[model samples]
Target: MLSHLEFSGFYFIKNLHFGELGFVQSAQGFIFLSGLLVGLIFMKRHERAGAAQVRRRLWGRALELYGWHIGILLAILALSRLMPDSWFVWNRWLGRLYDGGDVYVAAAAALLYQPSYMDILPQYMAYLLVSPLLIQLIATGRAAWVMAGSAACWLAVQLGAHMPLVALLDGLWMGGATLQPRAAFNPLAWQVIFVSGLVAGALAARGELQPRRLLDPQRPMLFHLAVGGLVFFLAWRMAITTGLIAPEVLERFQAYENRVEFGLVFLLNFVALGYAVAWLLVAGQRSASYGLRVGATLLNRLLSHPFLVLIGGYSLQVFAWHVVAVYLLRLVDWHVGPLAEPLNSLLAVAAIASLALPARWLASRAPTRLADAPQPSRS
Candidate 1:
């Protein structure tokens, strides 16, 4: 968004797809940072008391997430109804299920059901409900064991649980079968990333700083980030250039829609991109250049604002709102042409910035409570 407007007049920039950067990296960064922050908070909490205390505190947080989930679900439904009629259509019945609505009734009946919007909230609830077990595995003192066991559990969750469970509960129309078309965003398949985040958080809490320091800027982080990113791009490009990555798989990248369960390649690239962006952001913050300082200051302020941050914190909400806002605007009058794209991009940036304000405010009230939380044992 920032890129679109700031560089709009530049002939070379006008043709570039800045939205691709927005699509792939941002969510992964959010989730990764969420995990990192969780580690930072939980480990501190555990240090002040014990495992039992930490679990109890986390349980409360899990419940809060569930409450928030329900509220968000309701809000999505309300927004769907309030949207212009042109905004509501029966294109792909399965797509509606992705957005969180009735499965059987909507699919079989081919109806435009109210949007219940089930994505991050349900997965998060599942994660929270099972986090005690996750924490126990992480605290077991061996990184290999934590990684291996977490993988096994997450696999079990997908193969043994969510896919089958969703199938049984929602029927074939909206369950495992949907994986054929939208494999990446399925919560069942995507829990792998979430669990990976949990394990990463757990390891960080244990004072194993290798992963965090992997791109820590004080130590030539940019060089490492560049090397890593270059490697990924080369691999992807080579495969593409050689017709190695299958057409179906390559097509998925072109689909490029944002969803909770992104494909493995997309997932990897997204996280790597996130690391690159974050490292650059951090480096920019410390640079002596005036432009860097200005960029960093604005970034910090946007990230620091409480309401804006709260809205930012609830990424699912921001995404839903952004989509609705864009589509609704289009439906009202379609011929905004090339300018529409940049304008919508700018609007989204503004929305995200506004959302961060609340997040900053809420974070300010947390130091005292956070101070008392116990820390994870660091060996």
Candidate 2:
């Protein structure tokens, strides 16, 4: 449900341009859920197979993501060309992504140098590539080291460090090769969120995680944490709006990070928002009707309707379609101005309900003999 909301929110944020509250970035939850699911699934796979097989399976998943990432970029590049003086505004800067001579290199190395709004997929690929090591660390009972290492990487990047993958690729590309993305989501920084979710999922798979982790309303510490987080976030927003400069660069950067920065405020809101959502979901999961006019059963049914279920199930396909749709919508706004708003809204709904069919069709056409483990959906 959060994933669906986050995907929906992207449309609102991009079109209306204002959903950057402390706890509102849905991608954080989405990615975390992806990690969580992977953790759960990987544990199951490991039990059925072995640690080495789990490693191979994860790398295979990364390779699958790699293919999808490349496919989307290729589509975007083609669309960028197809839209130019004709209609959309995407043509204005799409060519800027690569040098003429470096086009092949850039396309080939898309994982290293993604365009703006395309950072998240590559980050997933990067994390998945190294997930075996992470899972091993946990499987071996070195979770503290996992936390320490993840936090260290995040803090280092937060303190101005960049990933070295781009730097390594610089040797091949002609002209200057700045390895960092156009807009950096800082995967190193985000590992903590994903890994934490991964740990939670793994624990749950092992029957170790408990609902009481968040369900205990009597826990004053948790209440204080939520209150303090919300207060600080709201206060920070007020301060910036009122023209009080932030005390530090990081604090200011979090205000306008291209996507959600997995920092303190994000963690706080994640926990608080997660608690609230989980509580609602648990309450709603019950089939028994409460006193409400629109009971939990109906709400749950709405949540599980074909459209929402399929969208959440085939989220990656929906996401790729979303990128293309957003760009095309921008084009419509450029030329067919009056139709843009209504068209965008229509696209959002159609995107959720219709994308899965094409995705299913494509999957049916795909080679069947290849052995890739089940996809761990973000939702």
Query: Which candidate number has the best TM-score?
Result: 2
Candidate 1 lDDT, 1-379, residue by residue in tens? 2221322222233334433333344445555565556666666566567678778877787777656655644454455457545324322312443344455334422211223223344455556666666666566666567567656654565344554554554445555554222322454445556666766677776777555456454565564665486576656656765789888998876554325335445555655665655554566566555765576678777768665547656564455454444344444433333344555556445644654544455566679678879978899
Roughly what TM-score does model 2 have, to 2 decimal places?
0.74
Off by over 4 Å in 1: 1-23, 79-118, 153-166, 170-184, 210-261, 274-379
Off by over 4 Å in 2: 1-23, 84-88, 91-95, 98-100, 103-110, 161-180, 217-228, 231-261, 283-305, 338-379
Task: Determine which window of 10 residues in candidate 2 has minimal summed lDDT.
Answer: 1-10
TM-score each candidate. 0.59, 0.74
- Find the 10 residues in a row with the least total lDDT in model 1: 1-10
Per-residue CA lDDT of model 2 for 46-75, tens digit only, reads 767878999998999889888887888878
Report residue 342 deviation for candidate 1 (angstroms). 6.3
Which lDDT values do the candidates have, in the order given?
0.52, 0.63
